[model samples]
Every structure is written in C-alpha cells, then in structure tokens.
Target: MTLLNVENLRVTFRTEAGPVEAVRGVSFNLGRERLGIVGESGSGKTITGRSVLRLIRPPGKILADRMEFDGIDLTRADEKTMRGLRGRRIAMIMQDPKYSLNPVMKVGAQLTEGLRQRDGMSAADARKKAIEALEAVQIRAPERVMEAYPHELSGGMGQRVMIAMMLIPGPDLLIADEPTSALDVTVQAEVLAILDGLVRDRGMGLIFISHDLRLVARFCDRVLVMYKGKIVEELAARDLMAAKHPYTQGLLNCLPRIGGSQGPLPSLDRDAAWAL
Candidate 1:
C-alpha cells in the first residue's frame, strides 16, 4: 500500500552565487500512515514537502532518480498530470490559514467550491457537505461561521476551516506543513486530533512536517529527523528518545525541561563528519 515513493531526491536553487543544493539525495516511502518530518529552519523540511507538490518556484529545480505516487512516476509527470494530483489526490494544509485562505471570500463559498465544481454536486448538496465538513472539524456553529469571511474567524477557527476545505475533496494524501505552528498549545492538540481522526477514518496518508519533536513523537507513527537537507535518522515515534543519530540526539538535548534545574541552555555541538 505504498502511496508515494521517493529516492535520491535532489532540489537545487539557482542563487546569484551559484546553484545551491537545498535537498540532497533524500528518499522515503509513505503508506496509509502518519510520517513526521522534523528539523530546524533551512533543514529542508518545507522544501521537501513543496517538492512533492511541484510547488517550487522559478530558479528552483527538482530532480529525483525515482519519485512515484500511487504507481505513477512523478519524476516524469507533466504539469497536466501534476495538476490532477495536486490538491486532488494529494492536498497540502499550509502553516497558517491567514495566508492560505481567501480574505474576501465567504467561508461557505470557499469550502463548497471544490465539491460543487469537481464532484458535480448541486449547490444545496455542496453547502450541506460544507457545513458537515466544518462540523467534522468540531466547529460548533458551522452555519454562522459559513457566512463569516476568513478575516472574521479566529486563528484556530480559520485553521479548522482550512482543514475542512482540504478534506472535503477526499484526497488520498495530505501534506500538513506545520499546520498548528501558529496556534496555542491547546488549539494545537485539538487541530492535530481532528487531522488524526480524519486520516484514520478515511484511510488516508499523512506527511506531517514540523519542528516540534514532542508533538511528532506523540502523534506520528514514524519520525524522520532531517538535518542539513538530509534524513539523518528515521525511527518509530515512540522510540524518538532512542534515536542514534547525533543530530537527532543533539536536537532532543536542546529542549528545556519544566521543573528541572535551570541554567544556560546547552548549544548544539555540530560534527562536520555527520553530514557526509
């Protein structure tokens, strides 16, 4: 049941200085499971996700020995094929809804647009599903919120709406790039729960990209620790503490513990040899 497979995936950007390799020879396979990618900024976490969707802009190039989705070779997929896959078979929920949602559009129109247009559902049916989608994400007053514009909803509500919009299409895979990075701890948990429930119920795959080690460890089935644009470690989420890679261990060590002795936080000690 391998939904997506990638091997020796390399992404380079044409910078003024020269070509910069953002992702170097990274590879992984995803099934109907939750896979978490964790790393600091510029560690290639976001770039890797974007590469899957072919979202990299000009001056950026994606190259892979093998990149397949559902038995189709993505490395050779043309724009037309990619368009059918992106947001249909594979959807991405961005880090923030404020930047993702349309500011001027009513939430109802935004949510039901896909269903009405793609699924051939009547306007009434689409509206019904849209409200159900909102309810699925635990929005209590979905009807009231439907009429409200994206700018009017709270941060958490806006995020839930984004999730509902993406899921309404029934995508096989969801790439959530720091979906709750902007929310509070409580809201983060709530959002993750909703995503987890939908993924499980619909038997869909998820690639969760985030910087929160603890959250990934708790929520994901497997964890991939990226450092310097490569996967330095891959381990079961429950066994994250037993990660053997130096980079992963160093990341775990940097977390500040509550009720523990307080002192100057330990700085990460990098080993040049680890990158090779």
Candidate 2:
C-alpha cells in the first residue's frame, strides 16, 4: 500500500558561502492517505515535496539512499522518465495561483495545453475535459472562466482553477504546498473538501505541506513535523495537539485562540541542538 518511500533524502544547494543543505536526511513513507508536513518557513517542507518530482534544477542536488515511487526508483529516473510521470502519475498544487498560473495565457488554454501536448488529446476533447475539471472544483460558469485570463480571476477562483488543472490529469500522488493559504475561510474549507473527496474516492495519495497546524490536524490522516530540514516528529493527525516534541508543542502554543488569551502570542524558542 506504500505509494512513496523516501529515505535519507538530502537536497543541497551550491552557494557561494558553501553547500547549503536544505533537506537533511529526511525519511518518510506515504500510502494512499493524507500525510501532512508542517514546519516553519525555510524548513525544507517544500524542498522535500519538489525533490520527489525531480523539479530541482542545477545549483541544487537531490541525494537519497532510497527514493522510490510505487516500484520505480526515483533517484535514478532520467528527465525523460520523469516527464512521463510528472503530471500523469504525480501532480503538484503550488501555494499561490497568482504565481503558479500563466499570467498571459487564457485559463482554457493553460488547462488543455497539457492534455493536448502530453496526452495527445484533441482540442475539443481537451476543452470538454477541462470544463468538466473546473466544474469538479465547484467553479460556477466554467465556460466563461475558461475564456478569461488568470489575472481576471479572484484569489479563490484562481485557486479552484489551479486545483481543477492539477486534478484534470488524474495523478495518483498529489503534493499540495499551502494550497489554501491565500483563500478565505469559506473557500479554504471548500478546497479542503474537494481534496478530501478526491483522496477518498480515487484512493489517491496526498502529501500536504502547510504551516497551519490546526488545518492539517483536521484534514490530514497523519502528520510529519519538520524542524531545520529534519523530521522532528511523526504522529497521527488527531494526536498533533498532544505532540511530545518541543518544536511541535511550541508551534501549537503559537496558534491564536479566540477568547483564550488577551496577551500577545508567545514566540517559539529555538534550541540549537534541535538542528543538530
């Protein structure tokens, strides 16, 4: 049932100062279930997810003792092989639609481009599929939306479009990095529900990377707490509030509660040894 198995994974960047290791020997396995990776900014959560798809370009290197997807060895996969897997078998939903979507391209074109180019789908078929995808994400009047450019869409609408585009390909494993971060509460909940339904119905595996502990706890089945490029804690999502690691506990303490306290939030105290 294991869909992804990453062990001793390391991502390093060749900086002028020295080689900066962003991901340090991180290891985890994923099944057809929601696995959330939570950490502060620059904690390597995004790096780990991107490494799986071999998305890291030069000046950066990904090394691992074992990085396998299903039965395929990911560490040794060439670009040609990776291209075959990228959107067809594995897909990623980036943090922001404004940055992720093509600014100049019409939404319809962007959505159907992959199908037309990669899958050899005809224009009519691809358009039909794209419209269906938009509908799946609960977008109203998908036809009009498709004709509009990315800039014409609102934040929530843009996000829904991104979700639809990513899901159109029917990937087996999805890496969503802060997918709902830019949306309002109502939109965020709807997006989460869409993701949840897809995972449940399609038996898809999900790697949800986010800084929102409360959201992850409610949405994901399991959680991986990262600190300074390493997984400091791994536990069931329901038990996240009761997490034993100082880092995880500190993060929970940082969450703002309504009517709980009138004082300013406490900052997370860092222990130098946690990085070692």
Task: Please list all clashing residue pairs in model 2, or write none if there are none.
Answer: none
Quick one: how many clashes does candidate 1 have? 0
Alpha carbon deviation, residue 31, candidate 2 (Å): 0.5
Mark the regions of model 2 whose C-alpha exceeds 4 Å error after superposition: none
Name the weakest run of 10 consecutive residues (lDDT summed) in model 2.
255-264
RMSD of each: 1.2, 0.8
**After TM-score superposition, what is the CA distance of residue 270 in candidate 1 from its true location, in Å?**
2.0
TM-score of each: 0.96, 0.98
Residue-by-residue lDDT tens digits, candidate 1, 136-245: 99999999999999989989999999999988888999999999988899998999998899778999999999999988999999999998888999999999998898
Best by TM-score: 2
lDDT (0-100) at residue 43 of candidate 2? 97
